[model samples]
Target: MEYRNLGHSGLMISEVTYGNWLTHGELVDREQAVACVRAALDAGVTTFDTADVYAQGAAEELLGAALEGVRRSSLVIASKVCLPTGDGPNDRGLSRKHIMESCEASLRRLRTDYLDLYQAHRFDGTTPLEETLIAFDDLVRQGKVLYLGVSEWTAPQIASALTVIRELGLRSRIVSNQPQYNMLWRVIEPEVVPLCLREGIGQLAFQPLAQGVLTGKYLPGREAPDGSRGKAGGRAPTFIGRVLGRPLLERVQDLIPLAGECGMSAAQLAIAWVLRQPGVSSVVAGATRPEQVTENAAASGRTLDDAVLKRVDEVLGDLVDRDHGKTAQMMAVKPSWTSTTP
Candidate 1:
């Protein structure tokens, strides 16, 4: 796998990293999880992404256990905070208490002394940005975390955190930001991508296939495939899932011939499209099976030419407009989304 710098930091992450989100602690059993991870490593995927709240941290533990025999220096492990962990109020947010406690718990679960990168799962309005930065700074000083990152953060939020870090002389640098980016979710482009490029913050793009919508496996008027993500995984949940229904599926079908003409699956074409962007340092690809891992890893080296990219832009115009509008509205109000449906 090709390696890219983790923003301005000295760390390098594999271009196609493995993620333990919906697949590890949800769909895939222990043996399958281990095999998928091993498959990734065999294909030279050295970066693995997880979070404290994913499957309530069971995903991290499974990943840690699976990496038992692999040399520590051979991989880059990243996890996130700011999502709820338990019933208590202190169990969530970017406050010092939660950040410190979550880091320790993640270390224990991952069986690693230090994290290559630790990210804020989302911004917390209740906590002072200074407190969060200082907590991350402390982890860097204590040798528990090597780099700091934020996920799903707006440009202003990330800028505020960076300002705090600089003013306080914090050792940890916000080197990366994780956001959903794919053929169907190009919302990050006009703002987030440009901001990261300007600030030298690398991007570890999530959902490079738009929660499996870009895979062309769900054609219009067809039943949702038995094992596909819409039928099996929980990444997008309700609101986004509803948005990804037939309209998006039809758009994906429109691109099937384009992928076929290029001698690739729609999934491979989708992944290749993300890696081709300028500011994207890596794309986080999650898998439930070893073969899927292999297929995604191979997508790293393939280049989506100018013509293909333009075609992708044309095909995704509706989705791009829709998500960008939603993101703008969300930033103007709340920076995060939560389930309101029972």
Candidate 2:
């Protein structure tokens, strides 16, 4: 698999990162989850991403168990914090207590002494930014986390954090930002990409397939496939519902033929499209089955020429969401710290 340095950091990660967000403990059984992880390894994927809040920490446990026999030095394992893992008031946010406790809990669950990369799952509006950054810096000093990252953070938030880091001379600097980026979601392109490019932070893009919408499986005027994520009846139905409108589905169908011309499935073409962006370091893709893992991993190292790239824009014209304000809107609507758990 193709590997890229995470932003300006010396560490390298596979372009295709296997992530278990909704599928590890909630959607698939342990056996299937293990099989998918194995499939990712077989396809040369050395980066694995998970979050402490995924399946209430079971996802990390499953991933750790799956990677038990593999050489730890050869893999890059990353996880996130800042979401409620319990019902207590201090169970969430980026406060020093939460960050320190969460990192310890994550290390225990992942069966690793330190995380290659540790990220804040979301911006904690309630916590002081300095407190958050200092706490993360302490982790680096303690050797529990090697690199710092943030997920779904706006450009301004990132800039503020960087300023604090530089002024305080923290031991660690932000190396990556994980955001929802795909063929349909282009919100990060307008603002986040430019700022990250200037600051030397890379993007670990998530949902490169728009949660399977770009896979061309959910057709217009049809109920979601019986066993698909759209019909999985948990968080998937709600999360994937926004992009399932008839108009969007119809636009996705237009790209299927274009994908064939490029010698890729609709999903692979969608992932490659995201990798072509200016500051992307990796595309984090989730899977339910082993074959799906293998298929998604193949998108790594494949470059789309200018002709195919232009055709993609022509086909997806006006359907893309490029508004930079959407990032703020998303943060505003995120589940309150008191509401979410594991």
Candidate 3:
């Protein structure tokens, strides 16, 4: 797979990174999950992304087992925090206690000493940004996390956090931001991409296929794909729900002929389109089968020429519009210092 430097850092990550979000321990069984990870490695994918919140941390354990005997130094292993992992108040958010404890739990589950990158799963509106940044800095100073990142964070939130990190002179700074990006979903292009390109933060774009929406398998009037993520009321109904409508499906079908002209599948076309965008360091995708892994891997080094790219955009038409309000959703959580009383 093709590799790119993560932001201004010296670290090199695979352009087609394997991410297990709704797959392991939920959609796909443990066996399939392991097989998919192996497939990604066989296809030259050296970057693997997961989170403690995924399947309540079983995804990390499965990924760790899948890569048990591989060369650790050759891979970029990443996980995230700032999400609820338990019932208690201290069990979530980006507070110092939660970040520190969560990292330890993740390392144990992943069977690794140091993570190549650690990310915040989402913005925590309840916690002070300083507390979170300082905790991340401590993890780096202690040699537990090499590079820091945040997922689904807006440009303004990122800017504020970076300012605090700079003022504090923290050794750990965010090198990447993961966001939902695809040909049909252009939410991040307006502000997040520009800020990242200017500030040396690269985008690890998730959902290049729009949760299988851009694959054209989900037909306009046909029943939902049986085993696909587009299945009605699937495990990720909330996220995948955005692309299940007929209008978007029709637009996606229009790109199929273009994909045929390019000698690739619609999914590959979607992935290639995201890779062509500015500030995109990697395309984070999840796969249920080995062939799916290879298909995504094929888009790693492949580039669509200006003609194909322009035609693909034209097919998208007004669907390419960006949504400023669609930035990362801020989650609310109760802090350890606060208690609710009736």
Candidate 1 C-alpha lDDT tens digits along 111-216: 9999999999998999999988988989999999888899988888887887888898876788999987766566677777788898999989988876676787
C-alpha local distance difference test of each model: 0.83, 0.90, 0.86
The parts of candidate 2 lying over 4 Å away from their true place are 331-342
Q: Is candidate 1 or candidate 2 better by TM-score?
A: 2
Clashing pairs in 1: none
Q: What overall lDDT, based on C-alpha atoms, would model 2 receive against the true structure?
A: 0.90
Residue 228 displacement in candidate 3 (angstroms) = 0.9
- Flag the better candidate by lDDT, 2 or 3: 2
lDDT of 3 at 102: 96
Ranking by lDDT: 2, 3, 1
Model 3 residue runs over 4 Å out of place are 232-234, 330-342
Question: How much is the lDDT of residue 247 in candidate 1?
Answer: 59
